[model samples]
Each structure stands twice: as C-alpha cells, then as structure tokens.
Target: MNTRTGKVIVNQTITADGYSAGLDQTEEHPFGDDGGDGWGSSLHSWMFDAGEENRAEVDQINAASAVIMGRNMFGPVRGEWDRQWNGWWGDNPPFHAPVFVLTNHAREPQPMEGGTTYHFVTDGIESALKQARAAAGDGDVSIHGGATTINQYLAAGLVDELRLHIVPITLGAGVRVFDGVPPRKLEQVTARAASTVLHVTYRVLA
Candidate 1:
C-alpha cells in the first residue's frame, strides 16, 4: 500500500507523568481516575476551562479532514454492536469529517448528524489508515485517542507529527502513552505554555 498523502497526526492530552487515562474506564467514568466526573473532564479541562487561552490548539483538533480512533475511545460497547450506541457525543460529534474506528468486530458505516460519519474497520490499523487517508484527500488525518491506539501507530512508524497537550497532574496507575513503542528521535516544532496546559508539537524526525 502507498503511504498516506496527508500527515498522520496524533493529538492527545496527557498528564505530567505521561498517563493518558486512569484505570477502570467505564461509560460513566470515561477517563477513570483522571478526576473527571465524565468524559474528558479531567485531562481536557484545558480546553473547557481555559477557553481562549488554548483556543487555537482546540480548533486545530477539529480541523482535521478525517480521524482514526480506537474502538474503546469511541464508546464502551464491547464485543458485538449489541445496543444502539452511536458515540459519547450526542447526534453530532465534534469531528465534522469521516471517522474510522479500529475494531475487531464488523459494523456498517454509521452516519450521524452533521457531516460526521463513523466507519468501522476490522481489517487492521493500516487498513483503517488507508481508508482514512483516502477520505481525507489532501487534508490532514488525526489519530484520535486512547493510549493503546496511538501506541500501535507510533510503533509502526505511521505517525508523522505528534501534538501533545501536557497537563500538570499525574495518574500513577492508568492508561499510559508509548508502552511498547521503541526509542525514536523527534524534532521539536513548538512548545507554548497556556494557563491550564503546555502545548508541545513534535515532528517525527525518523
């Protein structure tokens, strides 16, 4: 397969200790022990709380033409598509473009409100990326979260740029970033400090 035309970018918010999420994730506690009562409440306070301080970065995340994410990040629906679970978001998700969800089970393309459409890919990560790149055209492709998902892409050298929003807290036991990924040098592009988080961008030099 040919390489994707657009840059494979990953944007995630991590704690100071490098944990993406806490243990025991559920539908109610989407972020687990990160301290949020529900979904992104803990790590994403930078966007919700700070508002204009990180507005540019917040906007960048949604500007992607297409997105790829782990199944777990999509929702808590496990195994087969047992129930009518669209996503954590309501009728319309934040992403206004196509979203490829990586999973082992097969599910038809789910079209939601707005321009967002969820495509379930059971083949593999590379297959999902291939589909997303095609959908994205010349626009960028964002690797939407869940540490396990991003780790697989990074380990396979599929990511081109890494944009991380680093918060000041730590989750001692939680889902971490770069668990099995090997060492790789990254070129620093920019590092700007905000009121609630430090926005750091890195280009995968390798």
Candidate 2:
C-alpha cells in the first residue's frame, strides 16, 4: 500500500515584477517580449546557459511524479484542437511522468517517446489536481503553469509549496503570478541566487 502522501507544489519562473509571461503570446513568441533580446533568452538563460550552477533547481523541477499545466503552456493550439500539437518539448518531454493539461476541449491521451503521457482534463482545476495526485502516488504533484493556472490553484488554496525562479528583468504588462490569488502567509524554505536567476522556495502556511 502507498502510505506516503504527495505534496501539491507549484514550480514556475517569473520576472522581477512577477510576470510569468508577457502579452502577445503567439506561436512565434510564446513568452512574449520579455524585455530582453528574445522571448525566453534572458528569462530562461539561467536554466539553459548556467546549467551547472542551477542544476539542483533544475532537478527539483523535474522531480515531480505528475504535472498539471494549462492548455496555453501545453501549446498554441486552441479551440477544438484543430491541429496535431503535442507540446513545446517535442517527442521526449522533460517530465517522464503523467502530465495533466487543463482545457475546455476534449482530447485523447497523447503518449510520447519517454514515460510521459499527456492527459487532457476538461473538467476543472480540482479535477486535474485530483487525477494528478492519484497518478503521483507517493511522489509530489507539480502544478507547472503559465501563471493563470497557478493563480487559480493558489487562489483555491491547493498548493503546498511554491518554488519560483525569479529573473532580473521585468515585463511592464504581462501575465503575472498572484493576479487573483487571495493573500496567504508563506514561510520561506530556501533561497539561492544564480547568475541569471534567483531561486526561492516557500511553504504555503495553513
């Protein structure tokens, strides 16, 4: 029997001003104009460029047994799934576990090269979290988001831990974290500063 309980955690990257993504998030610019050279050039440089220094954080993000993400984060395809869009991660996605995507449209489960399988949940955030938790078993269930989704979970008081990779730059207007989330007390767990990003972990106090 699986006696261990899984923690509901959120792992996201945001700008200094708390924007997870800028406006005009098209296929060409997913993260939009991030106030840098390109979309994710400066914001995500710490993950791709300074890999050695931010290895631990990278590992933590990938440690989840099940992941929950919004349809927007999954792909640019919207409204009835007109095309065959797997995800931005190509065939072998980073998460070698079940990934639950929140969407209004219904779609069949998409199995990828790795152990990953995309399960589209059209119900709601609660339903997605429930499915993710069941699939996760003893492992943690990660709410991997595009800010809007994370905000919904945060507002619902479902997140146990919040991990953020804060970049230096700021987007004047963009999709932000804690947009409609109610004020909740958080206890700092850890904080580490890398070359391009600052990693912070906080425990959502009840």
Candidate 3:
C-alpha cells in the first residue's frame, strides 16, 4: 500500500497480536532475535522454503510489474555494509522485476545479476508509484511491505488488494501492521490454510 493514485497491493506476515516487524530490526538483530521471541523459524520457512503450494502463490504475486519496500526494510546489513550487499538473497533474487525502495537518502540505482533493478525513491510513495506504474505497464504494482509504509497507503485508501499471512504466534510488543490506518473494509477473495501458514487474500473495498 504505497501508491494512492495507482493500483497498489500489500503483502505481509502478521502475528496474532498484529505485529509485523519484530522489536529492534538493527543490523545485529537483522531478523530481530534479541531473545528469539519473534517468528524466527516460521518466518524463515515461509519466506525461503514454503511448500510448493505457497511457492506457487508467491510466484503469482511476483508476476507483478514492480515490488516496493520501505527504507527500514532496505537498511544496511551485516554491520554498516556497503550498498553492494543487494539483499539477503544473492545473485538471482526471487523478485525478477523492478523493485522500488522508498528512502529519504538518495543513491545510484543498483542493478543485480538477475533482472532486478533496485530504484531508490527519495521522494514519497506517490513518486515511487508513478515510476512503478510506468514500469509495470499492464501488470499490477505490489507493495512488499514494512508496516509503516503499508499504513500510509492504507490510510489513503490506495491498496487494490492485500495478501496477508497470519502466523499463530503473538508478539505482545512490536510493530503492528494495521496501526494508524483509516477504517476500511476488505472483500475476501481467497482463503487457504496450510500446515505452516494461514493465507488470506482480500480485495480492498474502500
């Protein structure tokens, strides 16, 4: 949910208590394992080794024109690492299309070995969407989240669809996914329950 004027979709994992990011996402605690109280094993499995059914769903999600992420989610990794770090995934990333990263700091576009081009947007989400829509053409524009960024777009009623994976655990104190968003309704498009994850797809209904 980062584009108010254009088609925007949000995909994220949430806990029973509604936390998206675990407490403290610093370089050292990349996945926020201060005391291993977060969704450590479940998150890893869901993102990296989700079963064939989950993988197929992700593949369809990735077929969109562009992917968007927030600055915190794109922060430096492994102790003040250089921009060359690219991301957690090496060489060929899961996302094979253009990826838009929203940040206040500006940097040169980073192109990876695969077809992924990391375009840093210094302006706000709207600017990012304009470029994303142009790049996407007829495909959908997807918001690969961080809670704050998603809330911004949701407050403005920009999201076209939302694909949420609800894990069973609950982090009492952490980043809530739906914080600071205006009241809105979502029409459930699909609901699939897997052994490891509960997938709920919704079409934003204003």
TM-score for all models, in order of appearance: 0.96, 0.97, 0.86
Runs off by more than 4 Å, candidate 3? 1-7, 33-40, 77-83
Error of 1 at 168 (Å): 0.8
Q: Which portions of model 1 show Cα errors greater than 4 Å?
A: 1-4
lDDT of 1 by residue, 2-120 (tens): 65477899999999999899988888888887766646676888988887888899899989999999999999999999998898889989999999999999989999988999999
Q: By summed lDDT, which 10 consecutive residues of candidate 2 come out lowest?
A: 34-43
Candidate 2 TM-score, true structure as reference: 0.97
Find the candidate with the highest TM-score and give its number. Answer: 2
Candidate 2 local lDDT, 1-206, one digit each (tens): 74779899999999999998888888888888877654678788898899899999999889999999999999899899899999999999999999999999999999998899999999999999999999999899999998999999999999999999999988898999999888899999999998889999999996
TM-score, candidate 1, is 0.96
Give lDDT tens digits, candidate 3, residues 1-206. Answer: 55434457888877667777677677656557423533355554665666575886677677877888887676554333355657655778778889898877777888887799889898998898888888887778888878888888788777889888887777677677779887788899999887777889889898
Error of 2 at 119 (Å): 0.3
Q: Give each model's whole-structure lDDT.
A: 0.91, 0.93, 0.76
